[model samples]
Target: MTQTPPTVAEAIRDAALRLAETSDTARLDAEVLMAHARGVTRSELLLRHMRDPAPKGFAALVARRAASEPVAYITGTQEFFGLPFAVGPGVLIPRGDSETLVEAALAAAPQARRVLDCGTGSGALLLAVLANRPQAQGLGIDRSPAALAMAAANARALGLDARAAMRLADWHAPGWSAGLGRFDLVLANPPYVEDAAELAPSVRAYEPAGALFSGPEGLDDYRVLVPQIAGLLEPGGTALVEIGHRQAGAVCAIGAAAGLSCVVHRDLGGRDRVVAFSVTNELAA
Candidate 1:
C-alpha cells in the first residue's frame, strides 16, 4: 500500500527540527524553503497552504538546508532594505545589519543625486538607496564578474537598471576612480571579517572567502578604501560604511586618518554596525 504524504505543516515541522542542528532560525528557514518549493510567499504558505500536501521535491530542499546551505542561496534570493535581490553562490548575501548603512546614507544625504557603491555585491545597497531616493543615479563597482552579473540582474529586476550601472573594478586598483565622477553619496560594505575569526559552518563553507575576510585584524580593506572614499565624495557628500560590531573605534580612526570625520551608527541591536564619513569640514549628521 502507498503511504500518505505529509501536510505542508508536517513537512516544515520535521524539516525545522532537522535544520535546528545547523541553523539558528531553523523554523523560519523551513518555512521559507517550503514557500520556495510551493512557489508561494511565506505568508501565502501560512494563510493558504498550511494544510496542503507537501510540495514535490521539498524534502530535497530541506535536506540541503539541514546540511547547512544558506536559505537565501537555496532560494536564489535575499531581501535587503525591503527590496528583493537576486543572489547566488559567488555573490555575498546582503545582511540586515547592513541596512543600517543604507539608512545612514539616506539620512545624511537625503537629496543625493549621484551615488557610488564600492564593493557592490548584489547591487542591493545602491539600488535600495536609489529606489527610495528617486532622484539619485548610482554606480556600483565590484571586482567579481559573477557578483556584477547578479548586481546587474537585480538592477533590471527592480526597474532601476536605467539608473544603476554595475562596473567591474577593484577598490585596490590604482586610478580606479579616475573616470568615475565624484558622487553626492557613497556606500560601502567591505569585507571586514578577521582572517582567523570563527564563523558558522554555513558561512565558512558556502560564502565566498574573497568577500568575507579582509585581513588578520580585518582593517586591511578600510585602510585601502577610506582614502578612496575621501576622493570619491563631493565636497559635502556623505559615505556610510558598514563595520563589524566591535570595529567602530578602528574603522572610525581609519576614516579620521583619511581626513573624513566619522559618526558611529548602531544597529537595532545597539551594536556598532556602520560608520558614516564625510570631508572633515562637512561631517555627516
Candidate 2:
C-alpha cells in the first residue's frame, strides 16, 4: 500500500521547525530535505507540492536532519562555486568559504596551463577551476586513497576527467614532486584549524580528523609541504592556500622563509581565509 505525502507547505514547515532545534541551517535544510523527499529540485518543489504520501524512508531522512547531521552529508552532495560535488562521510564537504581560495587561485593565474591541487578532498577546488578554464590541465593529489577516489569520481561527474586526474600522494613526503613537471599554479586548502578543541561540534565529531587537523599548531602540513613543493612551482607560478582565520601571520612567515612572498586574502565575512604566494627565487633539483 502506498502512503500519502504531507502537503508541501506542511513538510517544509515541519522540517524547518524540527531542524531549528539543533541546526543553525534550519530553513535551508528544510527546503533541501523536502525537495529530496518529493524527488524534485528545490525550485521545482516550490512550484509544486508533493501530490503523494511521504514514504517512511523520507521521514527517516527528516529524522536524520533533526539529529544534527549536516544537510550536505545527508544529501550526499553539495554545490561549490556553482557546480555539484559528491560528498560523504570520509571526505570533507565542499564549503562556500573555501571557494574564496579558488577565487584567489583563478585570479592569480587566469590563463595557467598546468595546475596542481594538493589534498584535493572532494576535488572541489580542482573541479571548480577546470570548469572555468576548459583548456587547463590539473592534477589533484591526496594522501588518503578514499579521498582520491572521491575526487576522481567528482572529476568524471564534472566532465573534467579528460583534463584533470587524481592521485594518492602525501605532499610532505620525500621526492614527491619528482615525476610531475613544474606547475604554473598550486591550489590547496590543507587542514588549518589551530584549535581543534574549538571546532563546532559537528566538525570535531563528524568530519574526518585527518581532513581537519594538522598537528597541535595546525602549521605542520605547511611547514613540511611548502618548502618541498616550492621546487615544483615554475618561476612566476603562484600558489593559493587557504589558512586558518587566526593563522595568517604564521602562514605568511612560513611562506617567506620558504622563499616565497605571501599575501593574505579575505572571505566575504572579512576574515582572512586564503594566502597567496609566489616563488621568489629559482630552484634546482
Candidate 3:
C-alpha cells in the first residue's frame, strides 16, 4: 500500500528541525521556504498547515536551505527599508544593518536632490533613499555588470527608473567617479569583512566573496573610498558609509585625514554601523 504524503505542517516541522542544526532562525526559514514552494505567503501557509500536503519540490528547497544557502537568495527577494529587492548569487543580499545607512542619509539630507551610491548591489541604499525622498535623483555605481543589471532592474520594477541611473565602475579604481558630478548625498556599503575573520556558512559559502571580504584588516575598501568621498560631495553634502562593527575609530581617522569631519552612528544593536562625514564641521541632527 502507498503511504500518505506528509502535511504542510509536518514538512515544515521536519525542515525546521533539520535547519535548526545549522541556522539560528530555523523555523522562520522553514516557513518562508515552505510558503515559497507553495506559491503562497507565510500566513497562507499557516492557515493551510494541517490541511494541505507539502508541494512537489518543496523538499529540494528545504535541502538547499539545509545546505546553508541564504533564504533571500533562495527566494530571490530581500526586504530593505520596507521595500522588496531582487537578490541572487552575484549580488550581496541587503541586510537590516545596512538600513542604518539609509536612515542616516534621509535624516541628514532630506532635500538631497542628487545622490550617489557606491557598490550599489541590488541598489538597496540608493533606491531606498529615492523612494522616500521623491524629489531626488540618484546614480548607482558598481564593478560587476551582473550586479548593475540587477540594480537597474530593481529601479524599473519600483518605478524609479526615470530617476535612477546605474553604471559599471569600480570604487577602488582611481577616477572612477569622474564625470559623475558632485552629489548632495553619497552612500556606500562596501566590502569590510576582514580576510581572516570567520563568517557564517551561509555568508562565506554562498555570498560573493568580493562583496564581503576586504584586505587583511577589512579596512582596505575604506582606505580607497573615504578620501574620494569629499570630492564627490557638494558643499555641505554628507557621505554615510557602512563600516564593520570594529571599524569606527579607523574609518573616522581616515575621514579626518581627508579633512572631512566624521561622526559615527550605531545600529539598533548599539554596534557601530555607519560613519557619516561632511566637509562642514556640523552634520545634520
Error in Å for residue 66 of model 3: 1.1
For candidate 3, write residues 45-89 as lDDT tens digits: 887664688888889998998899999999999989999999999
Q: Give candidate 2 regions above 4 Å deviation.
A: 1-5, 50-55, 281-285
lDDT of each: 0.91, 0.84, 0.93
Sort by lDDT, best first: 3, 1, 2
Judged by TM-score relative to the true structure, which candidate is superior, 1 or 3?
1
Candidate 1, residue 97: how far the Cα is off, in Å: 0.4
Could you estimate the TM-score for every candidate? 0.97, 0.93, 0.96
**lDDT score, candidate 2, position 91:** 93
lDDT of candidate 3? 0.93
Question: What C-alpha lDDT, on a 0 to 100 scale, does residue 205 get in candidate 1?
Answer: 93
**Candidate 2 residues 101-131, lDDT tens each?**
9888888898899989999999999999999
Off by over 4 Å in 3: 48-50, 281-285
